[model samples]
Each structure stands twice: as C-alpha cells, then as structure tokens.
Target: MSTKILICIDFSPLTPRIVKTGKELAKALNLGVHLVHAQPEKPSAPTAVVHQGADPSLGREMMKEIKELNNLKSDFEEEDIPCSYATPRGKTSDVIAAEAAKVEAPYIVLGSHGNGAMYHLVVGSVAEGVMKKLDTPVILVPAQQRLDREAGR
Candidate 1:
C-alpha cells in the first residue's frame, strides 16, 4: 500500500514552499498526497436593526487558498507527481489531524513562520497545537522560504 501524506494549507503565499517539500518527499517514498484547507467557523454578526447582508466577495477572496491549492497541484503534475486536493470547513487543527488520521497518513508536513520563542509564548503556535495531537510522523519546513531565491531551480 502506498503511504498517505497530509498537507495542510491556508492559501498563504508561504504554502507552496511547504507543499513543494511534501511533494518531493512523497515522490521519493511513492506516497499519495491530500492537500487541504480548513476554514474556521466565523461567529455570526450580532443582530442589528441597521445591519446589511454579509459580503460575498469577502468570503470568496478568503478562499484564495483554493486557488493556491490548484496552482500547487499544477506544479506537482508538472513534476509528474500524483496528488488530490480538498477544501474543508472547521477548526484548523481538528480538521487537519482528523483528516490525516482518517486517511492513515504516515506523514504530515507543516511550514513554520520561524516565529521563535517570544511569539509562540504569546499568541501560541497553530502548528504546535496540531502536531501535539497527531500520531503520524510530522515534518516542519523551516521558514527558509527560498521560493523567491530562484524559480525553475
């Protein structure tokens, strides 16, 4: 059976850096990739007599992650690597970890922002929270972020 790999994405420009790393590893190990973006539930705006409808473009723009995922898929295909993508809604950590376990992913790849000591101490790390709850081997792509260093390298 091929190894299953889970990659969490937020459509951040930083996502490709992380996805590329995971794709390389999957190619080396002949694993399948599940690229996902988990959208958190937004609290409903409080009832207001003067309130108007929620902005539609605001939500579609938020789904930039979906576009980024498709772009990554294209990149992976150009490399001749096979991958599948999905978009889910819910808490980021729960959605990622749950899907990973569901697919029996042997590996999970995450990219950090290098927000070292102080930042983690304050806002808390989303990646840290997800890793702590998953049983699969997890990889962190250090925030080297060298994508702009060169393209087609």
Candidate 2:
C-alpha cells in the first residue's frame, strides 16, 4: 500500500496554503494525498423533528464541503497526484486524528491560524489538539505570515 499524506482543511482563508503545502510535500515524497474536512457535531434540538435521515441544513453543509473537496481532488488529479477526501462530522481534532490513523498516513498537514494566546485559550487550537493526539509528524503552515505578506507588511 502506498503511503499517503493526510491534509486537514477548513473554510478558513488558510486552507489554500495548507493544500498547497501538502501538495508539494506529497509530490516530493511521491505519495498520494487524503484531504479531510471535519465538521462540528450537530447539536441536539429537542423541538426539531427530523423526518429524513439527516437534517436538511446539515445535509446542505455536507454537500458544500464535499463539493469543495472534489474540486481540490480534481486539481490534484490534473497534476497527476492521487487524491481522495472525507468529510467527517465530529470534534475537529478527533476526526482528523481518526482519519490519519485509518489511512496510516505518514504525515499530517494542517494550517495554524495564529490566533493570540488568549483566543486559543478560549477557543482552542485544532492544530495544537491534533499534535497532541497523534504521533505522526505534522506540517503546520502558519497563516499569520501569509496574511501579513498579503497586506504588504
């Protein structure tokens, strides 16, 4: 089985950078890429009754994520890079780690939004959480630097 690189992406502005970094690493390593988008678990609404398998709003969100993932996969394919994706709904860190483990990925690539310490303290950091949960080496692409560069700082 060929080793793969697991890349976690979100709707953040840093997602493209993360994908690019992962693509470069995968190309260098001659490995396939597995993209993952972890959606937060849906909160229970006691008053809401669902007649369908899943809530319509959640279904729409999932479809949107899948479409984005497909576009990314197509880009990889155009470059002759093998690619696949998963949209797992759950705690972000747990979902990423689980997918990494499932695929036995050699490396996990993700973006660091570079939020301040106070922000991270209250909101928590997905990159930090994934690092803590997995032994696989993680490639953290810093978002702040990119933002600064874009701003001509």
Candidate 3:
C-alpha cells in the first residue's frame, strides 16, 4: 500500500473542493498528500525568430503557480498533514498519471468540470484521460454538485 495520496490541482474554481476531498481521504487513511499541477507545455517557435533569453512573462507565471502550490501545501501542514507539491510541464492527464506512478500513491484525487457530452467529445476531459491511463484508484469530486448546492437548486 502507498503512504500518500496524490491530488491533482488545476487552480480551477473546483480546486478547493477537490483539495478538501483529498484532505478528508488522507485523514481517514492516515496518509500524506502530494499535490501536482500540470503546467501546459509551451509552444515551439522557429529557430530564426526565437529569442535567446527566456520570456519574462513565462517566468512570472511560473512563480505565481509556485506560490499558489506552496500556499496549498502550507494549509495541509498547518493541519498536521504531511504535504508536498510538483508542477511539471506536459499534457495534463499524462503529467498527473506520471506523478501518481512516481509517488506510488494509493489514491489519486481530482475534479470533474461536469462539462456536457458535446464539450467532452470535442475537447476531451482530463479526468477521463487520467482514469484510462492509471490503474490507481481515483476520487473524482463533481463540480456541479457544489454549484447546485450553493445556488440552493
């Protein structure tokens, strides 16, 4: 059995709910938590026009993501839960599955945006992709439930 639960963080509105679910599961299972943020790969440019130096804006964006991840880690630490994080550049589902495998996590936690079938068919869903790739258990938090409850629907 693995000692930690790997939680996928996309910084979406559903992120907090996903984190909350991860925390609950971690506590129940007496496990640590590892958070992963899949940073999208940057587009390639032709060598002729490529700038020699790294883009300043891209650096700033990375720093911001690091700060957010650190903040989430601190939250878990404050509650006496072991916490760690990683931000890897790649396809979202691939990064998530790779991280889970790397950590040997017992469970993977993430959110479903609850998009309709048309949207999913056109753009694909990360949750679906990750499930297809990993044998590890996944706890998927449904974003639509939270929205509906908040609206008293």
Candidate 4:
C-alpha cells in the first residue's frame, strides 16, 4: 500500500498555502495526499425536519463541503500527486485524527493561526487537540509564517 499524508484543511484564507505546503511535502516524501476537512459540530442546531426522507439542511451543508474538497483535490491532481478527499463531521481534532488513522497516514499537515492561542486556552485549538490525541507526526504551519515563506518562495 502507498503511504499517505493526511492534510487537515479549513476553508480559511490560508487554505491555498496549506495545500501548497502539503503538496511540496508529499512530493518530497513520495507519499500520496489524503485531504480531510473536519466540519465543526454545531450542538445547538436542531436536526433538520425530514422532507421526502431527506434532511434538506444537512444535504446542503454536505454539498458545500464536498465541493470544497473536490476543488482542493484538483489542486493535488494538477501537481501529479495521487489524492483522495473526505469531509468528516464532529470535533475538528478528533475527526481529523480518526480519519488519519483510518487511512494509515504517516504524517499530518495543518495550518495554525496562533492569534487564537489565548482563546484556545479556554476552548482549545484544533491543532493542539490533534497533537494531544495522535502519535503520528504533525506539521503545523503557522498562518503568518506561511505567508512569509510563500512570499520568499
């Protein structure tokens, strides 16, 4: 089986940078890419009323994320890198780590905006949470640092 890298993406302005970084690493490491988006769980949201045996709201949300995943996967494909995508719903870190483990990923890549470090002290950061949960190597590219690196490249 081919080894893969799990890339956790949020639909942030830093997404392109994250994808570029992941692609570069995957190329260097000779591993395929597995892109995963962890949709934050909304505990307060009520279940959508069943209409014709379908939850319209849930379907809309899934469609949105799947579209984003396809777009991201296309980027990897353009680089000639084998890639797959998934959008899992739940606690961001848990979902990401679980997906990584399921795919037997050897590495995980993600972007972090340390601007929220203070807030994370109260609520916890997805990056930090993932670090705590998984034994796999994680590469966290801080958003600001990524901007600098991209500019220099």
Find the candidate with the highest lDDT and give its number: 3
Put down candidate 4 lDDT per residue, 1-153, tens digits, no spaces.
457899888878887878888999999988899999876675312443433444566667667878888887887888888999887779888998888888889889998876555797788887778889998989887787656876896
- Greater TM-score among 2 and 3 belongs to 3
For model 1, the local distance difference test gives 0.73
- How do the residues 48-87 of candidate 3 rate in per-residue lDDT, one tens digit apiece? 1266655557766768888999999999999889999998
Error of 2 at 5 (Å): 0.4
Mark the regions of model 4 whose C-alpha exceeds 4 Å error after superposition.
Answer: 43-47, 51-61, 145-153
For each candidate, what is the lDDT? 0.73, 0.86, 0.87, 0.81
Give the candidate number with the greatest TM-score: 3
Candidate 2 lDDT score relative to the true structure: 0.86
- Model 3, 41: alpha-carbon shift in Å? 1.3
Displacement of residue 96 (Cα, Å) in model 2 is 0.8
TM-score of each: 0.76, 0.84, 0.85, 0.80
TM-score, predicted candidate 1 vs. hidden true structure: 0.76
Q: Please state the error at residue 7 of candidate 1 in Å.
A: 1.3
lDDT at position 81, candidate 2 = 94
